[model samples]
Target: MSQKNNKKRPKSRSWRGLFRRRSDPHRAYREKYLETLQYQHRTFDVKGLTTQGIFTLELARVFVDLGLGQMGQRPSTDPIPRFAPAQQRERHSIWEYLTSESLQNHNLAVLGAPGSGKTTLLKHLTLTLASPESLPESVQGMPRMPILLLLRDYAAIIEEEPDFSLLTAVKQELARREENIPLDWLAQDLQNGRCLIMLDGLDEVAKPQLRRQVVAWVERQMQLYRNNRFIITSRPFGYRNNPLNGVLVLEVRPFTPEQVRQFIHNWYLANEIKSAGHDDKGVRLDARQGAEDLLVRLRQTPVLLDMSVNPLLLTMIATVHRYRSSLPGRRVELYEEICEVFLGKRHEARGILYDLTPAQKKRVLQPLAYAMMLHKQREISIEEAMAIIDEPLSRVSPHTPRNEFLRMIENTSGLLVEREVGMLGFAHLTFQEYLTAVHVLDQRLEHELVQHI
Candidate 1:
């Protein structure tokens, strides 16, 4: 009996030590979490065409200043009222703005137009929060676990079964990192203001009714888990009023000229690093030269300057300029050329083979674009999208399965992107709007053209 009790004592001590380590939130555990985050996100996760390296540093370097301002008039297609309650605002970096005393207790609603770097900014914050090496002075020594939840994924779950808990999602995510803190312990941590919850893409919830539910869920979470920091991101037109009582609303400012120059330089430097590892030294020199040339052209062209304010568009411009040595002057021409390149030249360079001509591809896409416009939806489920796509596809390739063709398009065309398991949206809202405009032109709706423009 004495020997058995002695054996159990050591085993009990080991078990207790395990719980102790899990309960102790410190720098060592935080380092592990940061490693996991960096691995999961990687630089390829950036929106649009994936830049080759861990360009998080580049993103941070080029990070534009965010400003407070009255919600300006949005595009006609997106008529949702501004959500910010105040008229006065100031510009600040993510580090400076988020670390303020005013925002410590209040949740933040970050609103921007599509392709305006809202998602990228949130992701950069997440990576920074997790990484001790990159921690800004404001967030340094702040022992908080940053959990990023995609609102679309949460909404999909909510739509399937209304009883899904956000805590469950958090638990599953933490489990990925082997940090399975008890639910009650996690809740206590949140209530104690030790967690940073980043809810990304509130606008990505496709249905209005569904989005309202998500908004309500987020509000409930904020209220229930009081004192925790939360940053929720959404497009300008998709945002409604403050769902949380003390939420701070912020808008991502367009990139300024100097910021654009910085981004171009960083972008090429990162690409040069990527090329140096696998390609000839000449490739790196060419990349550097191309970036310098592009910057000069951007300064010379006012239209491109105005368009390049958008990070996504700027990246595309850089990409096109690298290969083609010129940019289209008109917005419509740019989109049209981009579409053709994505369908043909880009795919060819990547060694992907596609049999459909650009015209046939456009024919198949126009119907879906029109459908999205009619529905006023940015994303749709696979079932409905396929149903809408089947007719046009059947006419083009009678024997091909619609699902197979849809996969081909998704795999090849960077324009249409899969957001979640069953949801598909345009890679950027600009693409959707441009395609819709193309459809409208094909229909010769002159009055509607004025309205759309």
Candidate 2:
């Protein structure tokens, strides 16, 4: 038996000089807060591959540090505009430039299309900042307390508490670990130019009025914490109306063929290393061979290869290809397979059941997607969404409660996403477009669609 085993779960951690911007008077609480951030951001949560026996991958092990550039000026989802390939010289490696002094000195807004790795980049920065040992050159001697916040959470908080400021949010974030931190600790840090403020997913704010408030709030914080580093992320369209002044806009460039190859190699190698649980020589040759096979398949198929540039979709392709050993050549077939992977395969793997079948899940969501496209809204409130989905649900799942269907769809299917409190939307814009087109064709709404066009 073990020796009395009394470790009491675990605290965050103890790190030497993690945020060396200055000495902390409240060392205990500060370290605890930093540890929490480190734990939360230090892993890549890859989904839909549980059957492959990989649920979480280490952030440091597989992170590829995809470059940033002026990939495109618009957020349009058209292939050319959204995913313009970047030449080597035109982009800056995230490994080299992410925490460079020049970037740290100025505020920045990183915009990218859906699944283009904007959030991943922020999380990478968070994880590295949390653990400076991982990025010695990138973050050493320039450590700032990495305060990462999701803008959606910010919006939700402020809506309930009108007096909630960024300062309050940070304090609350720390307080959640414990209330031992002095009230002046964060303020002193902010005053002394010692914080890296990262706000992620501006597009997820959903409501326009609340978005305006969030932007204004950010602007206010930038002014108040004039010396601290700030980085905000969003899709290009979400930021077009109220673009911040003096903040550099860097678009997340898609993975070029070379980067794609590197990511594939890294992903497989990392998985093999994790599965084998050792680093002995020849522990796993499967990673090297499997990466080659996946790369070959992508190289042979133009559409799949083109889709490989986007990191999230490419990751899905890699996971799905590994399990299935083949890829659908057509974009439509690929989308259908993605839906099946998310809606059916995921739940099947977990032995979970729902009232609606995979096809019926799509059936209920098609009209909602059609309505969203018709009105030019990517997200709808839960009430409005339930109302729109009511008719479709009645047709497919009359016995199922609407809220129960919504809950199952959110939990099991993974196609419907809640961007924020009381808000719902499709996980991807491409999914919405495909479902909307299906709806139009099935209902013979060509004339109505043509009129709108």
The per-model lDDT (C-alpha) reads: 0.62, 0.69
Q: What TM-score should be assigned to candidate 1?
A: 0.62
lDDT for model 2 comes to: 0.69
Question: Clashes in model 2: which pairs?
Answer: none
- Which residue pairs collide, candidate 1? none
TM-score to true structure, per model: 0.62, 0.68
Model 1 scores a C-alpha lDDT of: 0.62
Stretches > 4 Å off in candidate 2: 1-25, 47-53, 71-73, 76-89, 94-104, 133-135, 141-143, 160-162, 174-184, 328-334, 337-453
Ten residues in a row with the worst lDDT in model 1? Answer: 1-10
lDDT of 1 by residue, 1-453 (tens): 001111110001121232347556553444565677766554533333432233343455344444433234432111111223343234467665445543444567877654566777777777666564444565642325667888876686776766667678877777866774556655655656667788987766646688888888888787766656688887643575324455667666666667778778767766666656544677667666867889888888755666676676677777666545446444565677656655544434433345676567777787788778778888988888889989988898887787766655554444566656778777556667777778778887657646644
Per-residue lDDT tens digits for candidate 2, residues 16-50, read 45345456567655666667787777876554443
- Tell how far residue 119 is off in model 1, in angstroms: 0.6
Task: For candidate 1, give the lDDT of residue 187.
Answer: 60
